[model samples]
Target: MTAVTDEGPGQVRGQVAGQGPGPERGRNPDEGSAPREGLPKDRGRPGRDWDDGLIARRAVSGAAPQEAPAAVPDDDVRPQVEAYVPSGSPLSPRLDALRELVGLSRARLDRTDLAEAGRVLDEAAARQRLSSRHTVVAIAGASGSGKSTLFNTLAGAQISEAGLRRPTTAAPIACSWTDGAAGLLDRLAIPGRLRRRPQQSGTGGDEALQGLVLVDLPDHDSAAAGHREQVDRVLALVDAVVWVVDPEKYADAALHERYLRPLAGHAEVTFVVLNQIDRLPGEAADQVLDDLRRLLDEDGMALGEHGEPGATVLSLSALTGDGVGELRELLGRFVQERTAATRRLSADVDAAAARLRPVYVAEGWPGLGERAREEFADRLAEAVGAAAAGQAAERAWRRNAGRACGTPWLRLWRWYESTRQPRGLDRTVFAAPPEEQLTARQRVEQAVRTVADDAADGLPGPWAQAVREAAVRGAQGLPEALDKLAARAGAEPGRDTDTDSDNGEPAEAAETAEPGGRTGAHRGRAAGRPPRPAWWPAAVLAQVAMTLLQIFGGLWLIGQIIGVLEPGLLTPALVMLAGIIGGPLVEWSCAAAARGPARRYGQEAERRLREAAAGCGRARVLDPVAAELVRYREVRERYVAVTEFSTTRG
Candidate 1:
């Protein structure tokens, strides 16, 4: 009773033999000599000499045939044996999950590739996965290909009308196994009722066959292009395709070139059922299948038990039910393999995710640079100050002028105290030459205009225009502002004295007159009376000559005695003569030298007032604008730095 070891192919064979239920297994002598069960079974079948030719030639050339190593006994624990298998190693669940994910990704990519043509490939893929309980095998082919008859035979009823009609099955007809699984039909949006059949006897041999859903779509080569589109669209989403062709049209270039050739990669999920084989003789059916295999091989689909070369090929008559059971059994096996749906769904998701990648990319806004903001701020400040400087200078000038030309009473007090004598009215009032008289308002207006013009020079564009206009408006307001300031400053005591009569006569009259006579004299002066005569000369001149003679002469003592006797009359006469001779000459000399300098001084005083007013303009208006500009510059710099930091990090 030697224990059977699960090691080499011979050991597997011995185990199978021991487990046999019949004597035929022991009666077959070659059973023990057969290769392992995993090797391809039909490798030595007749007329399959294509693979055999390569092997035979290799053998004839005396090449040493390489053999696979014998499987080691599970009990053998050699040093090189990293691990041992309790039974045959099964696929890891992780590997299956990875494979499913890869398949899903591929399906999604395929859907996306087809999406540019306005088709929702992913939706089709999802619908296919959801309807997996049914085997949605579409029979796609050109017109007159006998697809309707095949559909009727597979359905086991006269479901499709097959006749000499020009076009048939304009829309798809879906047939489901169970009544409730008609939900599958509703999912397809097919408007057909569930026609229940008594459970057919042979349908339940394979449990996987119990829930199969079959769909019959419109012809791909129908005159209506929409029908062809429907065929193509349904083919992409279905679980498996059953390409039904007759012997004549099986080799039809249009069918093979347009659909079958391009869909070679989908061979695992495809089938080619050569229909109306009853029309071909027994030998022709086999010959046609052989030629079809050769064609499918050329198209990269290899035939095994499947109707497709790489897929399954079945030669059957829908009218006679030949080979229909084999088709059903094959379909059942395919349905049992439920992993394709998961694989396809995952692929679709991955592809859709890839397409949405571009939307997630982030962008930032452009910002003003720090240096540019700083430069603009500096220029704005300068422009503001320049416009205001003129007003400031005007204010300064008016202050100096007002102080210089203040009250004559103050001047008189100073003079009287210094010389111990009362000062004349003319000398006190007319002192300091009347302050180059002009109003502070007038000075400010002129200075504002000049300063504004200077500030506005060399500016360009809209900002320049804005700055110029603002400066002009600001300058125009300065005169009024300065007038107000001056009015307020000069509002104190003694302002009337500074503003009174030019020569002090009116003031002297006001001081000397009695109250009742003052009104009469003011009225008389209002009538423009002639000024009084300027005579104090005769007595003073006579005294001055006598005094000079007593101090300096004895030779002219007689002349001195005569001078003393008639001093009053002679002095008066000589004084009148000197006035007559020198009055015009003195007036001319004084007027000639003083005219231009006096005019210039008056102009300078006006100019200074204008400048002070301009400075006031800057202080009241432009300085705020400058402060605002500085704030703007600081904010702009911070904004630029933030944007720059974002860009660098990105």
Candidate 2:
């Protein structure tokens, strides 16, 4: 039974035997549907067999009609559409990989340039969500090709009156074997009154097609541009297609050049039907079928001609029902396997991946983080004048040692020079010139730029630009940070006591408050002002003894000159000579011993400065560059997964 309800002018809704009420009339189907920019607004449905205009009715089981159409977001609502595929299925990995590709591309690449990929994803997502239980197949052909006759023959009922009376199929019509396909038809923007179901008695042997939805598309070579537009749109969405051709138009240039050649990748879900074959006389039918097979092969469609797994071509006569049963049997088996949807989606993914292949790396990925880090640290170390600081420390140690152990006359001369210079010897006696400081700052900037360049090397344009931008963002305020470190570079490290352990090892120096460098060496400080050696006291005592000997000899000579005692020139002179020579010998020994400690002190100063600079570099540039590379790596991984899925399937 069927119920008709007329809600408004030119608006109609139908209620079938078991299917529920349709949506309210006068509402646009596209208000909640996916993008269909090129489709026409509905005046009336096409391809309906009924004398009455645009009405479809079907009887279904109580449990057949789904409560909701595949409820998925439209393209306007969600920028990247994700389709539902059951986990562990063959199509699941590829679907997930394609979704990830779209997302990553939006984030890394220009959004404006992804129109084609986004369209593919949007259409595929909508189709998958519309009905997992249903498979949509379209029958398409040129004008007067008897495509509608084949469509009606496969449907077991008349679908459209366009086969021989007219030169073009005005629009598309849909015939479904089961219910719950209203959402899918809505996706194609089919009117509610235009969908139909085959008679219940006629569906007896078609149990394999329980969820099949067949669409009769308009003439592919129709003179009316609208008919051809409708054909292309329907063909793009259906899971599989059966192209109907007659003997006259079997090898027509319009069909092969327009539709067959471009969709060669979709051979797995394709069928080529040679309709109206009974019109061929004698063996002409076989000859035309063989020739059609040759043309399909030339069009790059994988075929079952050599028993390979590919498109199935067959001869049929819809008027006489000669080969219609064979097509039905083959189509039933195809629907039963349920690989059509997956195969179609896989082919779409293949096409999208091919277009995007040029933007990614063709070979192995190499990282430059470790090498860049070391080079960056070295550069910073050089920028902060670490080597120069070390040299100053060495010179200071030598100068202090000379002061402590030099002859009295030389010490007096050094004191006079210090007084004239008016500068203390305990600290950094030399200041960096303005020009040197400017050069150091420039080197710091150069180090950052160098790391940024290295990070971006060999990357694709967008990723390389992203890495350089990240480096710049992280390297802000680096010069000021170095200046703070350099200010503390000359500070002296404190020592607890001027004593050695029981094993004769010097006590460790206290930790410096400076950040660029860690604690100095145990025996000496970064400032090179080490604790007095154990032998220093002995040298000082020996110098005191020598001075006393000289003093005693001088006093004796004075006493003799004053006539208070007898003069002994040889003994006194000998004692004075020994004192003079012994003092010089002590000074020479001390200078030689301090050389080793001075070198060690210089090394500590340089090491501390280098560490400070390295820490600054890491904070400002290296870590951020690494983070950018990590993000790029993730994007690359998604690309790899997408390519692998397509490659393995192909």
Candidate 3:
């Protein structure tokens, strides 16, 4: 039931209800109330010996009782209530920001219990709908704070009983100025018996208080546990709170530490009313009010629209009715401005943002870099046997080319060599492609996992999970795709043979050159085929010239022997020897020249095969992995955006 009247800088008027120093705490406020059966011995303050009948009359007229102590002049106090206009207006923009944040983080929030957030959001919408019609303010305090008295003073009627009872108001009592707030009161769960309208509603003086719904909540520090629970529940849903404190317990740890400190952001809608201030000596009241302001500052509660030190603090004697006019006037302005609900919601958004900061704090989610991606692809290439395939292509090509352009005699032997199966390669393993298949598939899967792990490293849980999912999406079907690609690459190495088959002349010549004899010596003779070297025609023409020389020389020798021509034995014999030596020499030189072409042909075949194999590696393994890297990058960017958006400004 605390209420404040802000006059100017360094000055505030408020009301409270006790007469001694602030109380010493026996337990932590955070522990909540003890069990109902374990109530403290001094359940509430000792009863006042003062006349209750005199207090009630003074409260109705908003004046202090004659016997109460005199209060200090307002200017003599150094400053308790700073003039506070709530900082932000029209909470729609902040609400929209918060709603957008919720939408963006919906997936993450779904994992957590949503009750509190749901309640706050629901309350915000409800408050917005009723914004023009009502501002619900709660009057809450500890035992012996005279909160009920203050509630009656503000309403100008004794709606709530003000007495020495430990927990006088077990349930909330709602006093509405206007008639249209029944629904709002229903939302607050105020019983029909506890709801009341201003006593003299037709008086134009009540116009200032229109749209105001003041609720007197049960004592927060009540002996009964349920009373405190009711206070807490209402505090959470109320648009504004007036915390009532007597001069004695204004600095109660349970009040500041548990409630005020946690709600530091709600300072704009918070009013600190020092009740029973008339019980204190004039100077003592100022000292107590200043102390309460200091404690609130320590609670991190910013007071004014300019972000000052504390909420509006004012002193008043509810029993004496002192400061009641200022309190009513302040509340009138509070209702007329119609921003308490918006301010409360804005504060709510700030609190929620602070609580949720950890989840969206951006760090270590840079994702896979280009160099890492290339390295990953390289690793997969080796695992999938890309390099081995390339080398195999090169070897197969050399074998095919060797048979294609070798010397005629050697080509015949090489063709026969081609028919022989290669040794050492496990044909059994080849027969079961599954074994080879597993190797490539496993390699790819491991690579995918590794890259994903690296990308997710040092990231927050949700972003890291997103990175992992992206990697998985990119990796889907990759193993089978790579297997097909490798097979194609392997098949490419054998394509040269098909191309050779398309040239019918080579096959026919090859079959003709095959050894056709049974005996080993006759096999060599059958294997001898004329070399297809470029110099073969020159060699053959030279042999033809030599044969003609030999034949003519032989004819001349025969003529000499038969005395049918002039005889010259030296010339004819020399001619016969020269022709025989030169013909074989020419043929031998042509065979030597053909060897280089055969080697060069084999090298060309190897180069083509190697290119094909490397191409397969790029297409099958590197490309898919690169695609994954791209996805990782995209997710990383999104994570960064989320973090920045969530943290930088709330």
Scored by CA lDDT, what does every candidate get? 0.42, 0.63, 0.56
Sorting all predicted structures by TM-score, with the top scorer first, yields 2, 3, 1
lDDT for 69 (candidate 2): 23
- Ranking of predictions according to lDDT: 2, 3, 1
Please give the range of 10 consecutive residues that has the lowest summed lDDT in model 3: 3-12
Clashes of each: 34, 2, 25
Report the lDDT tens digits of candidate 3 across residue range 1-650: 11111121111111123311123243324222322222122112233222222222112233443232112111111112211223343344455555555555565445352333444566677655553557889999877778888887777767777664456787998887766666667667777767776565546457888878899988776766666656766777788999898654565665665577767777778898998766665476676677677777777886653545236788887877789889888888888987677666666655655555545544654556776666666656555444433333333333333333233444455445544635422111212234545665666678778777776676656656766776677677765555455444434423322112312212222221211111111111112222244555665576577667777878878988999988779998888777666655655664455556544433443344334433544454445545544544443343343333331121
TM-score of each: 0.35, 0.69, 0.62
- Residue 555 CA displacement from its true place in model 3, Å: 21
- Ranked by TM-score, the better of candidates 1 and 3 is 3
Off by over 4 Å in 1: 1-121, 128-132, 179-183, 193-208, 302-309, 339-650
Candidate closest to the true structure, highest lDDT: 2
Compute the lDDT for candidate 3.
0.56
Q: Which ten-residue region of model 2 has the weakest summed lDDT?
A: 1-10
User: lDDT tens digits, residues 1-650, model 1?
Assistant: 00111221112111233443122121212221211122112211223323222111101123232232222211111122111111222212222332333343332223333232122233433453343444555666545556776766655555655654546768776655433444444545566442222134135433655556667777755555556555655554455678886554455544554566545545666779877666564476777677777778777664655342247787776656687778777777866664333332232333322333322111332122344333433332232222222222233233222222323334455445545534453324321112212233334444444443343333222223344455456555553455444333322212333212433322222232222111212211221211111221332243344434433343244445677543334554454455433433333343443344434433443344334434466575455434433433343343233222221100
Q: How accurate locally is residue 318 in candidate 2, as Cα lDDT from 0 to 100? A: 75
TM-score, cand. 3 vs. native: 0.62
- The model with the greatest TM-score is 2
